[model samples]
Target chain A: DTAVSQTPKYLVTQMGNDKSIKCEQNLGHDTMYWYKQDSKKFLKIMFSYNNKELIINETVPNRFSPKSPDKAHLNLHINSLELGDSAVYFCASRKRFQETQYFGPGTRLLVL
Target chain B: DQQVKQNSPSLSVQEGRISILNCDYTNSMFDYFLWYKKYPAEGPTFLISISSIKDKNEDGRFTVFLNKSAKHLSLHIVPSQPGDSAVYFCAASAIGANSKLTFGKGITLSVRP
Candidate 1:
């Protein structure tokens, strides 16, 4: 079984459009994270949630928001996407005290 | 500021040979380091890791070495197979950082038979 999964594997939208990516984990993990891999192939963490509570909010723009409906799901919502928003968004999850994180197949976003 | 850095962008190795990937970090507070491998169109998968207290870790043909003083680390794959070709990422996390990892630019490894 896929421990972590993401929906909308590919998203292509125009500038000023909004988009959302969904993530789900079945590893019974309590912590979920959202990361972005830019054109330079640098993967950076944007937000982290533990038990549906926001724990880490990096220096990301307010246009990007992450919502966790429950411990098993975390979704990212982007408002007024720009060309810079075109990159691969990855969702990861891990146990509260564990160090290893399981990642899902990334969702590639292209904002023209 | 790139906390973690993989200076090399790519590495090519012949099958049945040892492939070494190097990484360095600038943050002294980092205590945990990990290596992840990713294929095209997929997310990275955990490979090996080492803690600051230890100098080396080994699992099968994959081993990771850590040097706390130099803030350097390396991953060695012995007898690299063609299937081992992928992009390798080096990541580090500091204590009390809520498991937030700082990743390097990643090195693409190509194993040719």
Candidate 2:
């Protein structure tokens, strides 16, 4: 069984268009995270949620918002997407107080 | 500024050989370090990790070494097979930092038969 999964593996949209990526985990983990890998291949964390509570919010812009409906799901929504938003987004999850994280197949996003 | 750094962008190794991937961190508060492996179009998977209190950790053919004073760490894969080729990432986190992980630019390893 897949422990972590993401939907819409590929997304191509124009500038100013809004988009959302969904993530779900079945590892019984309480923490979920969103990460972005830019063209430079630098992977950076965007947001983290623990038991549906916001825990870590990086220096990301307000245009990006993460919502967790439950402990098993976390979704990312982008408002007025820009060209800089073109990158691969990954979803990860882990147990509380655990350092190791399990990631899902990334969603490749292209904002023209 | 990047807290974790993987200076090498790629590495090549022959089958049954030893592969070494190195990583460095600037933050002194980082007490936990981990290595993750990723393939194209796939998310990273956990490989190995080491804590500040220990110098090394091993699992099967993969081993991770940590040097607290230098803030440096390395992953060693012995008898590396062709299937072991992938991009390797090094990550670090502080105990009280809300489990935030600082990742380095990954190094792509090519294991040849």
Candidate 3:
């Protein structure tokens, strides 16, 4: 079974539209996180959830929402997207110790 | 505003030679450092890591060294192989809060056989 998986491998949307990228992990990890990688390849953490509850919500705009329905699933929803939103979004899972983060295939979102 | 930085955008090394990838961090608060390798169209995979308390950590041919006072860390891959070609990223996480990591811009390493 796949340890971590994310849907919509590619997404292209117009500005001001809403879209979502879903992620699921069967590793039974308690922690889930969302990371954004810009064109320059710098990675920044956007959000983190533990057991369906939000834990680390960075300074991201309210348009970016992370919803964890259960311990195994975490999804990202974006609203009123902008051109700057064109980047690769990755979903990751890790244990409490933060020992290692297992990442899933990223979703490339392009807002025009 | 970038906390972690990898100056070299790319490097080429012959097989069986040593590959040294350097990384620097501006934040002294970063206590844990890690190295991750990524292939094209794939997520990064953890290669190695070192804590502030330990200056060096080694796993097989990969050795990670940290300089606390200098806030610099490097990953050395002895006898680099062609299969080792990929983009390597340096990451740092602060102590006490497991608060996610800050990654560098990444350096592409090409190992020629």
TM, every model: 0.98, 0.98, 0.95
Candidate that scores best on DockQ: 2
All models: lDDT?
Answer: 0.95, 0.95, 0.91
Judge candidate 3 at residue A3 and give its lDDT. Answer: 86
Q: Write the per-residue lDDT of candidate 3 for residues A3-106, one digit (tens) a residue.
A: 89999999999999999999999888988999999887888899998888898988999999899999889999998999999999999998877657889889
True-vs-predicted CA distance for residue B69, candidate 3, Å: 1.4
Which stretch of 10 consecutive residues in model 3 chain A shows the poorest summed lDDT?
A: A93-102
Model 3 bad stretches (over 4 Å): none
Docking class of 2: medium
* Model 1 clashing residue pairs (backbone): none
Ranking by DockQ: 2, 1, 3
Clash pairs for candidate 3: none
Candidate 2 residues lying further than 4 Å off, grouped into runs, are none
How do the residues B11-107 of candidate 2 rate in per-residue lDDT, one tens digit apiece? 9999999999999999999999999999999999999988899999999999999999999999999989999999999999996537888999999
User: Backbone clashes in each candidate structure, one number apiece?
Assistant: 0, 0, 0
Determine the iRMS, in angstroms, of model 1. 1.5
